[model samples]
Target: MSETVTLPRPDDWHLHLRDGAMLTAVAPESARHFGRAIIMPNLVPPVVTGADAAAYRDRIMAALPAGSRFTPLMTLYLTEETDPADVVAAHESGLVTAVKLYPAGATTNSASGVRDFTRVHGVLEAMAEAGVPLCVHGEVTDPEIDIFDREAVFIERVLDPIRHATPGLRVVMEHITTQDGVAYVREGGPDIAGTITAHHLVINRNHLLVGGIRPHYYCLPVAKREAHRLALRAAATGDCDRFFLGTDSAPHPDGAKESACGCAGCFTAPNALSIVAQVFEQEGALDRLEAFVSRNGPAFYGLPVNEDTLTLARQDAPVAYPDRIDAGGEDVTVFDPGFPLHWQVT
Candidate 1:
């Protein structure tokens, strides 16, 4: 076993850096560990065009802490009204690295998302022709499907048909959470990959209900069962190029998340690596940690691996709960912040 290891710094293939204050508050956490992150475009008035992506990129740049080496890879939010010409322009101009497809009403700020895949045929064709990837939310929004079964159902109903319609299009199944999701992405063939989030590797549905409902563990494509969590761990650590890291580290203001109708998202920025490291270590696959966290993402994105390096150590430590960046507003706790972590960032 390798006593110590270092690898190219990782990038977050999927992330939601909300605009303005929230953006300013959370951008630094990711910047601290990642060299680049594919920024999600689902803002209030989502980034639907090249100009919007460019402007959002500028905001992310300005928000970065001084001397931070982080780069924000922008994406266009795909809506039914998205123009094929705009997608072509964005890809050609290099303003966007990918296009995000959120099934309408799937998650936060996704009300503007495309309601029907058939309606965006031109945009998908344009993206494929331009060699840009389509990053999907990958869950059906229909009310009848059980919350836990939504992803599997979407894979069979929505994603399968979409893939059939656009044979050459590159796709990333964002934040995959189920065995079915893992299996689907695995069988979907090349030019297709899935991003596994750090939180899902650590928490399952039992964590949500066992000790009474834990609101902080709530996230879109909500945590699945222990079996699914185990499946995610195996996929992330296994020799599958189809899976990699995407923290999906969304933040919700304390008021919004702790309310009667609590929002779905975990502010996992602070404890992400530690949580992921713990998972790999528990599976006796710490040696494979670097690949899942550092290598697979850039390989899928077709970007060169990072030159910088980071370390993870087998040290038991406690990441504080209610992470406070300011006074009196409210304390924000990461998904598993209060718990003791067996692996720590070095």
Candidate 2:
């Protein structure tokens, strides 16, 4: 007999809906499964001020499908020249949700990110005072540091110091990919939390480089060893409010991804809920699925749990999902979990 589970509609704590054609193509996929999402702010020029955030929010609303109730929670990309007053004003007006910190050259379109952390101290202080959370792309870009070691090094060299200096600052370490990251969040107080991506829970570095280089599986803070993957699985399945779903569902054109130097991201929004449900069932943590995807994120963000519900059912036949999302002129590949998916959102 097939089993089914129904829970409150989930919200994506971290998501990337690129502007223009890409946004129009993928926003509906997320809207179909999640009620809201914390939209990333690393566009070409980046969203760095209250006005930028407000205008971007308008574009997102315009891109949404007719009659869709999905809401985009906007964020500001932090830079050295970022005005603390602008961030406060944005939060007060509900034009922005949080501020994103991307270390210089850490990931795509991050060239404009902060190089000297001290320069943003005033902005961080203002965010703490306004009760606005800081969503961080937790990786250091020092060329000397190995790519796989960036996240772990970031915690010790950067994250810890910043949090210690700013009291009462709420932070969400976005897309944590290490055992060290899991342990840090497990031990942190209520003021700190971490978001675990859907793809990270399923793939490790081996999946990206085993027999051949799989660009579709490649992502920033690139997947770590199998042990780290297991740690991420445990954190996501455990009953901790600090750990929640964030599909970092980034999309790139096929040509761009298959090139000599491909971008780093996994496009998983098309079937994120199904992929996550399969993982939860495999780990024998199906009971905690609702809390992980629905309750915890809203509680951490100080928002209300969604009133609507989503239902997933296990079918005898494997679930079928589109292999790619057609973004106007280019095709964006969907993440393949290397296993047949049986659970599907209904």
Candidate 3:
């Protein structure tokens, strides 16, 4: 006998659909599972302006398979020189859903990110007034801070102060990987929420470092200790609207990931739904799956839950996922949850 759960088609609140060939290859994977996604804008040059977001959205639409209803909710990449009026105007026109903040040198293609938050003060104020949410890659790039402590330090040194000063600014702490992150979002009142990645809920630092380096498990705001992973699971599976799903389903080609200096990302787009469903079930909170994946995100973003539905069934046997997906010629590795996956979206 099999148990099944049907929910509104989910959204990926934080997703990376990289441009050109990579975009064309991976956009369909996300579209196949999610009804809408707040697409990341950290392209090489970055999508900094309204025009850039529009053009990128057009490209994403063109890349999707015909008749697919995948809506790419676009975003602007924040920089020190970003204009407040431009940010508010884009949100008002519905040209972009949010503005992304990737602190300088924080992650892939983030060299153009902000080092001086003070420079973007007016823009943050304008966003607050206009109800424009800011999706942040919540890690500090300070060289002195230990890599594992960046997220907590960032919250203490940067995130809290910013939120205090910029009241009413709706902030989504994207791919939060710490207990501190969970606690902050839970206590930060209505204006702040956190996105927990499928990978984070499933993997920890051990999965990345134990028994040799697993490059595919490496991601920005990299997975933390098992305790942190447990907190994320509890947060995602509990009754908390402040936490939602954002696979951060970043795809890097095989060569780039398997390099002398490998890139940090996990291409989990292909199996995100299945992985998430299994995690929810294991935690004995399958009842909360709909809210975490489908309902909570739209509520936070001031959008409606998707009318369409996705069905997931628990099977007696493990569901097989491909080891790699081809991008042009190179293969992008799919995330393996380290445990058998029984629940699959149909």
Candidate 4:
């Protein structure tokens, strides 16, 4: 016998749909399941302006599969020189949904990220007034700080200060990977929310470092201790409206991932739903999966819940998933949860 659970078609609050060939290859994978996704703007040059967002949106739309209803919610990449007026105008005109803050050198293609947060104060203040949400990478790039401690240190130094300076700023702490991050968002008031990745819910530092280096499991705000992983799992499945799904499904060329200095991301878009279903079911919270994946994100972003639904069936046999996606001349590996997944998004 097979058990099934149906959910409102989910939206990925954080996603990276690279560009050109890569975009063409990966866009359909997400479109096949998700109704909408907050498209990342950290392109090589980055999507930093209204005109840039509009143009990028066109590219993304063209890349999507024919007749696909997947909507790409475009965002602007915040730099020290970002114009508050431009950000507000794009949001007002509906060309952009939010603005992303990547600390310089924090992650892939983030060299243009803010080095001095103060340089973007005006932009942040304007976003606060205009009701545009700020999606932050949430890790500092200080060389002295241990990689494992960056998220916690960032909370104490960068994020909290900015949030306090601009009181009404709606912020989404993207890809939060620490118990500290969990605590901050849980205690941080209504205006602040946190996004949990499908990979983070399943992997910890051990998953990344235990036997040997696992490049595919690496992501920015890298996975933390087992205790932190458990904290994230609880926050995701528990009764918290401020926490929701953000897979951060970044794709990298197979060579780029397996190189001497590999890229930091897990190409999880292909099997995100299956991985999340198993996690929620294990947590004994199947009733709440819809809220975490579908309802909460919309509630925080001021968007309506997706009207369509997708059903996941729990079958006797483990579902077989594709190992890699062919993109241009290279391959992008899909994330492996390191376990058998029985739920299939049918």
Taking all chains together, the TM-score of candidate 1 against the true structure is 0.95
lDDT of 2 by residue, 184-296 (tens): 98998899999999999999999999999999998998999999999999999997779999999999999999999999999999889999999999999999999999999
Model 4: pairs clashing at backbone N, Cα or C within 3 Å:
none
Residue pairs clashing in model 1 are none
Residues 284-315 of candidate 1 have per-residue lDDT tens digits of 89878888988888888888889989876654
| Candidate-wise lDDT, in order | 0.85, 0.94, 0.93, 0.94
Relative to the unseen true structure, what is the C-alpha lDDT of residue 338 in candidate 2, on a scale of 0 to 100? 92
Give me the overall lDDT of model 1: 0.85
RMSD of model 4 against the true structure: 1.0
Relative to the unseen true structure, what is the C-alpha lDDT of residue 304 in candidate 2, on a scale of 0 to 100?
A: 97
TM-score of each: 0.95, 0.99, 0.99, 0.99
lDDT of 4 at 52: 97
Q: Give me the overall lDDT of model 4.
A: 0.94
Per-residue lDDT tens digits for candidate 4, residues 1-346, read: 2389888999999999999899999999999889999999999899999999999999999998789899999999999999889999999999899999999999999999999988999999999999999999999899999999999999999999999999999999999989899999999999999999999999999999989999999889788999999999999999989999999999999999998999999999989999999999899999989999999999999999999999999988999989998999899999999999999999
Clashes of 3: 0
> Where is model 2 poorest over a 10-residue stretch in terms of lDDT?
1-10
